[model samples]
Target: MSERKMCKFYNLNVPDRRSGSGDGGALNHTGNEDDDRNEDEGIQPYVPPHEHKLEYSYWMWFSQRPPTRDLSTTTTGYGQALRMVGRMGSVEQWWGLYSHLSRPDELPPLSNLHLFKLGIKPMWEDPANVNGGKWVVRLRKSQTGRAWEELCMAMLGEQFMVGPELCGIVLSVRFQEDHLAVWHRTATDLAAAARVRDAMKRILQLPSTVNLEYKVHKDCLRATNRHEEEMNHRS
Candidate 1:
């Protein structure tokens, strides 16, 4: 779907009503063309069909590197290219948007898709993520589509039992192997990180041959800057 069309389906200014009940109170909702028209006509949002609320709200983002630019998690003005495309508070809402964006493999190389908590920017420096770390797995192009979908479901369902320690998921598209990382809120919480890792393995049904790595966000930021400095010196 076109970016403009997709934005029409999400209410960016949803009311804040998050509740422990995981229902009713939430600052999230998905809209459609009908709802857009209704808003313009001073009518209520188009109520979804059999809408069941999720425990937490989320935002989906899309970003891509310029052909000659190297985009990293630490890159400045990263938000310029990172677009918040959809927000979801219910299962049907997620399915509505997912149906339009079939798979990441279909996206161009250097592109990345992020599904993060409602208020969290999909960036390492975002306060919720600065001290966090991510568990990353590289899979062949053929393996990413299914894995990415399942990972999305698992996170939305809170299957890890890590609580809010689990922040979001990032799917980085590349030419051959694709990298998918699950971000957690605390890097020092080894127990939480371990649970995230174990849960990811079970959810993705990863094979023993698969290598999963963990990198603290701060470490990644430092490494990225160092690498860029080296590249500059070389040139």
Candidate 2:
């Protein structure tokens, strides 16, 4: 089946609602001070501070303005901050950001654009992604635009992998090559990860000669260091 059709099938299988209604409003009973205290002592429910409407505005503002060099002053925080701002946790805002942003080839080498959910850092060290990994597809420098566009469309269109386990996608541009990756929260979830990778391969229509690799975040960190060492040796 086609990638789009497969996604639709999975969506249909997802349960529409919870099976049981146990303690449905237990956390929202304002009068129960003890319950509230207990809940607070435990884990607080996730509430996104930024509004989706504001995120859309920010995305448009950033896209229309030319890229700035002085990130320290121009952007209050690092690259991740921009990603967090754009990831407003709403489908509408996410689509808006993707539609307005430039593709990978339009950006300079070593530049990256991460689209992760709000409150989740793109890095592996983040609590949400500590045990995760990414399925990577490296493209020749000439195919950067093709690979980038295909992966971005698959991700934002929710065609790559569309479950809660789907963390995000990343595009990394290097001097000689570019990479498109789908980040997942669990590296051990082979079935889910395989589905994601298959979706990517199909959408990108990768050449049979190209070999895609799935790397755990821990492994990637090590591989990065090794590559740096090799580059230094060549120099």
Candidate 3:
């Protein structure tokens, strides 16, 4: 099936009416009287049938409504991560979460935010991400707004790093600058990683003056200093 058809297969919106009027003609005197009688009898007006149903397969777009059940929200970071992971599968639901979330540049400095698939944790310890790495794009403080937004859109829209190899993406905002990373499921697959990085560069359309880097999760965790020197030395 075509991409548009695939998207529509998952989207359940009511088809629009072709003709303006129904089978019945304009109201006559007799019909007016019947309508008045119906109103007097407390008969309700007609409501069109809802085309969509609430199911696991469908997700809502950019909704502010929190999960109704208590189980989805817990004290642990892992629990919150789990909640996020569970909601990432359906396109509709992913859109809903996207709508409700704060845009990357709007987050406070020194804040770390992660968006990943339901089963995948943003951290390295998760099975899906254990041997994985991330391509980091460090944006100047001024470019945070546009860069972060484009990166988030590219990640969530599946415009980059196609297939199951993509785990998630993360953004870290700091006083000096902001950092964006696309996390993948395997670090050993250099070809796949290169593809992801190239896709990212194309999407962002960065200038030749700007530089981007990719690092393994293990190396990042072991780094004592958060600087270009440490990163270069590790590479």
* Best candidate, TM-score: 1
Error of 1 at 13 (Å): 16
| Candidate 2: Cα lDDT at 123 | 64
Q: Evaluated with lDDT, which candidate comes out highest?
A: 1
TM-score of 3: 0.57
Per-candidate TM-score against the hidden true structure: 0.77, 0.56, 0.57
| Candidate 3 lDDT tens digits, 180-223 | 78888889999999888888888889777777788897665444
The residue ranges of model 1 lying beyond 4 angstroms of the native Cα positions read: 1-50, 70-74, 227-235
Candidate 2: Cα lDDT at 186: 86
lDDT (0 to 1) per candidate: 0.75, 0.53, 0.53
For candidate 1, the 10 contiguous residues with the lowest summed lDDT are 37-46
In model 2, what is the error at residue 115, expressed in angstroms?
A: 1.3
RMSD in Å for model 1: 7.1
Q: Candidate 2 — which residues are off by over 4 angstroms?
A: 1-85, 88-95, 221-235
